[model samples]
Target: MKLYTIDTGFFKLDGGAMFGVVPKSIWQRTNPADERNLCTWATRLLLIEDGKRLTLVDTGLGDKQDDKFFGHYFRHGDATLDNSLAQHGFHRDDITDVILTHLHFDHCGGAVIREGERLLPAFKNARFWSNEKHWNWALHPNPREKASFLKENILPIEESGQLAFLKEGDLFSPNVAMRYAYGHTESMMLPQISYKGKTILYMADLLPSVGHIPLPYVMSYDVRPLTTMEERQSYWQEIVDKEYILFLEHDPVHACCTLKQTDKGIRVAETFALENI
Candidate 1:
């Protein structure tokens, strides 16, 4: 099996919202904000090449949103989904699976594209994987999360007849298993991949960045902040016990990191690029 870091691009998000309850003095030290108080974040995706099955973990915030909509989140960068995939000598048509951690616009928006008046699945031959609970939550989104779950980005996969739900407790692949998390969103699937006798946990929104290692640094966007705190504590304990490599999704600076138990709690022991692993 081979893995590739597909960097779709970078975008800006309100730092205060990203780090819920954490003071600017604290979070700004790690993720410095711009003049507008927006912190730059990477919409980094992961690609898994297992023989003939090419799986893309998540899609970045797509380019289909209108200028007015995009102006809010300053999406800027040279890297694109197409170029990133091509760099690995592959194309959208070659992707066999798109495992979405959640249906948030930033995570699943690129799964569909607008062609003329019709919205279509970005990967023509890929089976879009999302859990049943998350699928339902996104389809009938609550008022708070309605803006993040765009109908255009979603619904198309189901309409295209390419949507599949992983059964609860189902192993995602030969070397990967699914762990359900609900703090960030309902039934968010974090892929626990076992490779070379080591586990690489795809830290979707459960732990967006190394800065979020502290149990209290939960995102404001999370529906259940207390649940997030509990989830992080349990997950971090397991990460330290197993020495899992955390693959960060939104961290602009670091790609992966290892955690060690400290007097305070679990903290990042070392940060390095995925290639170093």
Candidate 2:
């Protein structure tokens, strides 16, 4: 099995919202914000090459939104989904699976693209994987999360007849298993991948960045912050015990890190790029 870090680029989000109740004095020390209090975050995706199957996990915000819509997020960076795939000697057509952690715009927007007046699946041959729970949540989004779950970014996969749901405890591949969490969104699937004699947990929004390792640093975007706290505590304990490498999706600086039990709680022990492993 081979893994590639597909960087779709960076966008900005309000630091205060990203950090939830954490004070700027605290979070700013790690994710320093710009003049507008927006911190740059990477919309990092993952590509898994295992013989016949090529799976792309989580497409970043695609370049389909209007300028007015994009101006709000301050999207900036050179990395693009197409170019990133090409760098790995692959193309969109080469992908066999699109495993979405959740259907938030930044996470799944690139799964579909606008061609003329029609919105369609970006990866023509890929089966888009999302859990049934998350699929329902995104389709009929609540008012708070409606903005993040754009219909244009979603619905297309189902319309294209390429959407598939992983049953609870289903194995996507031999080296990969799905773990579900609900703190960030309903039934967000975290891929636990065994590779190179190491376990890499794709830390979707469950742990957006290494800075969120301190337990209390939950995001305001989470539907249930308290649930997130509990989930993080349990997950971190296991991560520390087994020495799992966390593959971050939104961390602009760090790609991956392993946690160690600190006096306070679980904290990052060491950080490195995925390729270095």
TM-score, cand. 2: 0.99
Against the reference, the lDDT scores of all candidates come to: 0.93, 0.93
The TM-scores of all predictions, comma-separated, are 0.99, 0.99
Off by over 4 Å in 2: none
Query: In model 2, what are the clashing residue pairs, if there are any?
Result: none
Q: 1-277 in candidate 1: lDDT tens per residue?
A: 8888999999999999999999999999999999999999999998988888999999989888899999999999899999999998999999999999999999998999999999999999999999888999999999879999999989899999999999779998888899989889899999988876789999999999988899999999999999999999999999999899999999998999999999988899999877777
How far off is residue 227 in model 2, in Å? 0.4
Tens digits of per-residue lDDT, candidate 2, 175-277, equal 9999989888899999999999999999999998877889899999999999999999999999989989999999999999999987877788999999998
Runs of candidate 1 exceeding 4 Å displacement: none
